[model samples]
Target: MLLGCLPGLAAVLALALCAGGVERSVAASGRQVVARPAAAHKAVRPHIVPRSVWLDDDTRHAQPPPRYDDRVIAVFVHHTDSPNGYDCADAPRIIRYLYAGQTGSRDWDDIGYNFLVDRCGTIYEGRAGGIDRPVTGAHTQGFNHRTTGIAALGTFTAGVPVPKEMTDAIAALAAWKLGLSGTDPRARVRLTSSNSHSRYAAGASTTFPALAGHKDGYMTSCPGAALSALLPGIRETAARLQGRH
Candidate 1:
């Protein structure tokens, strides 16, 4: 009877050992799942909208987009140099200043650009979305009525030039706009010294047409020299964002 009980006890000890060993092997093989702490499980980041949305979010005090004369034949670029490039993050504030001056001083009621691109490539909403529509702006000569203005915060005339990221944003926006306007996204959009109808023929298979600096129907340095040199590239990138080949 003692021997029989001994065998039974051994069998029970072996089963316990096997079960324990299997658990240890699972832990050692890195297959054991660790339950997160209760507090940790609740910590997750939320999605965020852009700062441009904040500019347009005025409860009942908001302005509306214009209903007339928005042909948007071209896009112009500018730099906010008077206040300096270091304040790129405060571009919306500058927009407010411009809108005040354009309205109060120059007799227009809002910021000039349809869009403003900051040094860090952040795009902000501008005048085209405002109420009491502006038919005139100081963005370009002979074409402010027909052109869509897009300003970048940096003075890239002689500096190291506009960053490629900025060019990318400009291109993407331009491309998307082209798609909406029923224009060929891959066309060359340049205001030449010889033409006024916007050239959409001289582009690579991947790039969209964009009006280059000094090409608009205006006489001023619209996008300047350095940054202007990158318009073709910008247009191409913008086209791709619209899912064109």
Candidate 2:
């Protein structure tokens, strides 16, 4: 009788690792106990167009396999630095152009950004890796690992009228990506710099907003002034999406 009870006890202990809620029987107390895992604070993943939509085999470059980190704790926003007055229907061509420039002239393994958002609010996967995975990007100089890079499809210099649709999509993507690691969009996270080209020296540790601009980690005007000004509101929106206050 004792040996049989031991196996039942072990099964009940394993319930703690399960996500959501689980119930266990308490024979001694003649009551049921509920065991729930800690809340993940995850948000529903926003729709993202796959890389194949932009980079076909004809245009695809032969690059090494993608690299990854444990999880994404932050997001670095950027702009493609191209003209903004483009038809949303032409977004795929624009992305392909950017990909050519990066992999051809810049000699990067792949497109730097992990994701890109068009002015019409369409989100597209930029890099080769899975969007749900923490694929290290080349968007930020030193803080690429453990962070996601989201590029606005066009330039957003000061006084530019950033599209509300675009910003909304960015917020949703950020919320989902950051939530995967239980990171709050409005909070700060500590990260180590891997390159001296960044604002922080190599090996330096610093704290930055979980949702931040490219300038936050590197010395650049990327994600531009107009977009940078919207970051606070974006953070709030992202947090709300994640079910955070």
Candidate 3:
């Protein structure tokens, strides 16, 4: 009984020491000294998108079953494929229109993208699930699971100048989202294709940039040429935000 109690006491002592870095110091007089406070690790939280900023209270819909993945490892950038000349003040309305179109006309359960960014760099929350959760989206057909979709709120065909602010916000958002799982934005990750509509057959494993373009997974020229061209820089900026050299 004494030996059994000794082992349990030792285990508790070890746990307590590890919890807060318990230290032992000796003074010149041979008396035990107290430990100094340990420094805290740096926290890197960027702007977290609020759902209220984009989701109107009246955008009523029936609740669909939620889908989620283990974690997010990739980000796919896209363009809304709508006109680019609208005033920034009308962004919410435009987003609502897009949401309605996708849900009502296209019959999707909800807006596909995980997030949306305007030309002015304002980030808006998309989808009906929690932003921090790995909510499986319907944006990129085969690569929806374990990934995030950020749609730039405009048509960005070739020669259409992609806004700097938009890309910057995208980088910040990507950094925060990827950093949550300690994923390197500039790295390549292999994901199994869930749909054959993608470049690879269903269940084929493929390697792609952690920050990928919509076209990388599917044949459609989504995200458009201008925005796609900006993805490399976005990836680099996101990595830097995550403190990657």
Identify the candidate with maximal TM-score. 2
C-alpha TM-score for every candidate: 0.57, 0.85, 0.80
**Which wins on TM-score, candidate 1 or candidate 3?**
3
Over the stretch 61-97, how does candidate 2's per-residue lDDT look in tens digits?
9999999999999998887766779999999988887
Which residues of candidate 1, in runs, are more than 4 Å off?
A: 1-73, 130-138, 185-209
| Model 3 agreement with the true structure over 1-245: per-residue lDDT tens digits | 00000112223211110002345666889887868644332126556566576667687556687799988888888777767787988888877776665666456677777888988998888886787789988778778889988888777778999989999999988888877666788888889998686788889998989898888887667777888888989988898877776
Off by over 4 Å in 2: 1-37
Model 2 quality (TM-score): 0.85
Global lDDT scores for all candidate models:
0.45, 0.81, 0.74
The residue pairs in collision within model 1 are: 103-108, 171-238, 172-238, 187-209, 189-209, 189-210, 189-211, 191-215, 207-236
What are the RMSDs of all candidates, in order? 29.2, 15.7, 17.1
Using lDDT as the yardstick, the better of models 2 and 3 is: 2
